[model samples]
Target chain A: MENLIVEGSHGVYFVPYVNFNAETGECELAGESYLEDTVLFYNPLLEWLDNYINKKREAIKFNIKLTYFNTSSSRCLLDILNMLKDFEDEGGEVAVNWYYDEEDIDMQEEIEDYEIDTGLHINLIPSTDLVKHQEDDDDE
Target chain B: MEANNLEKKAQDTNKFDLFKYHSLFNQNVQISYKGPFDSKVLSVLGTYIQFTIGKNPKASKKIFNIFIELAQNIAHYSAEKNLFGVEEGVGSLVIAEYPEHYAFSTGNIVKNEDVIVIIEKIELINSLDREQLREYKRVQRNLPQREKGNANIGLIQVALTSANPLDIEVTLIDDKYSFFAITVKVDK
Candidate 1:
């Protein structure tokens, strides 16, 4: 399976960055995701995870560094996180790191909700580190 | 408080100033648009709102998120379709900035029969605290498609995001139609 790389854009609708590596099973969804068609945009990512879990059978490291996501996008994120939870439950090695704005109480609550709802342990990282990493990546 | 009086007068006289102007009320209206609530329109309007209120990051974030949900609510659920060729949710939206909080208001027509369920959803949201609202939203979002009904999780999300009760007004347009309006306030 080839890697999925989507360049996130901030036009009329914010599209989140998606990088799903077929080789390493390291995926990261970054930036804001307020899409025109929430399901249409996220369905492919879901399919990618499904394939990785079923076919690849490799450990997955998922990183979500989103500054903002609307409710529609939140539903899609829940779907993705639930998939990861299923994979973890099946004795698959899965680590999910969610990076959010530190000062955003709403985002913090949302992350907590996702954890309780999906029954998945997620590492909460502040976006301060994520920001420095982005800056470094930009320099490359 | 001269501007306050003018805004009250406008609201009392049912004369909401549309567009970028202080025609008959205060300059509280930061943004106003009335047209087809399609994806293109939503995107542009969302951007405009972001730009206009970008000064206050916290308030901007709350209002923007609420605006998107409410705008999409209008886009997806509004009964009136201004455009003929496509499925469009046509409605009106107004964002007013007061001293304390920013108010996001949107309205569209709905079928009279559905109004009861809509009110029930709002009342349910209004009845809950933050924790209960979160749980309710989770339960509703996790429901099967068949059991979901039209009471969308978006409404609950709107309530949670704004951290304020939904102010709803429904007017009977006719036997089959009623205008449903919702206003949510986000503190600045």
Candidate 2:
């Protein structure tokens, strides 16, 4: 399966970055998401997750690094997380990592909420160090 | 005693000068909508305000966010439901341009019993400085997620984006309902 990459207007669309890899079983979503059509944007992503989980052949690692999202987007996010939770319940190996800006207390809380909402252990990774690394990569 | 008298005279003179300046600054514009907030209208107006004010990108984003949040709040929660089939929520939204900044205000009828909770929430948000407000939002976000429509994150987002305290006033309309007005300013 090829990766899904769509460049969206940050702060306009609820999810700014999305990377779903079929071969690597790595999915990453980042940035601010406040999409006009929440259902339309999320449906395909949901289908991909469902396929990954149902196959039982792919080990998945999902990463979320969203700074801001509206309440509507939050509901849709919950839907996505619950799907992953169901997969975990079925004895699938899945790891979810959430990266937030160090100063963004709100983002930290959001990750916690997702953990509570999904019953999945989300690795709350602070982005300050990771951001510096990413910047160094860019320089290279 | 002499210093007090001199201060009084100075204040009176300053008030008179301010009144004269206010009379000279006569530029005012009022845009009002009564019905469901048409996204079409909002989009056009949002662009117009951005261009007219020549606001920075960040400020423009904040204004747009505030507009969308407040309009949605009215659409979803306003007690005065629109009778017309075209509009789902009935309320009045106004945006006025002042010399220094733009004032965005919204008013709608709310159930009397619900007024206290809304008022308290607004008051709590308004009283906090930026740091406290950020902490409060963090605390609220960490709580267990609700099934649906339960997170009050909208208010927090509005406050954060605008970088201005929320101004909320409530007036009793009747035994069952009250008029709630909320206003916030966005700098150019």
Which candidate ranks first by DockQ, i.e. highest? 1
RMSD for all candidates, in order, please. 6.4, 11.1
Q: What share of the true interface contacts does each candidate keep?
A: 0.52, 0.11
Screening candidate 2 with a backbone cut-off below 3 angstroms (N, C-alpha, C), the clashing residue pairs are A13-A34, A14-A33, A14-A34, A14-A35, A15-A33
| Overall lDDT per candidate, in order of appearance | 0.83, 0.70
Residue A55 lDDT in model 1?
Answer: 95
Among all windows of 10 consecutive residues in model 1 chain B, the one with the lowest summed lDDT is B143-152
Name the weakest run of 10 consecutive residues (lDDT summed) in model 1 chain A.
Answer: A131-140
Say which candidate scores most in lDDT.
1
* DockQ of candidate 1 (2 decimals): 0.42
- Which segments of model 2 are wrong by more than 4 Å? A1-19, A24-47, A50-69, A74-140, B1-30, B47-54, B142-150
TM-score of each: 0.87, 0.61
For residues A1-140, write the lDDT of model 1, one tens digit per residue. 98998888777678788889999989999888877677788899999899889998999999989888887777788889999999898999999999888889999999999988999999998876554222112111
The DockQ figures for the candidates are: 0.42, 0.11
Residue range A1-140, candidate 2, lDDT tens digits: 56676554532223466788888889887766666666678788888888877764577898887765676676668788888888888887888888877775545655776676568898888776432111111111
**Residue lDDT tens for model 1, B1-188:** 69889889888999857543546446898777778887777877776777768888888888888888787777777889885766878898898999999999999999999999999979989999999999998887676532212225778888988999999999999999999999999988
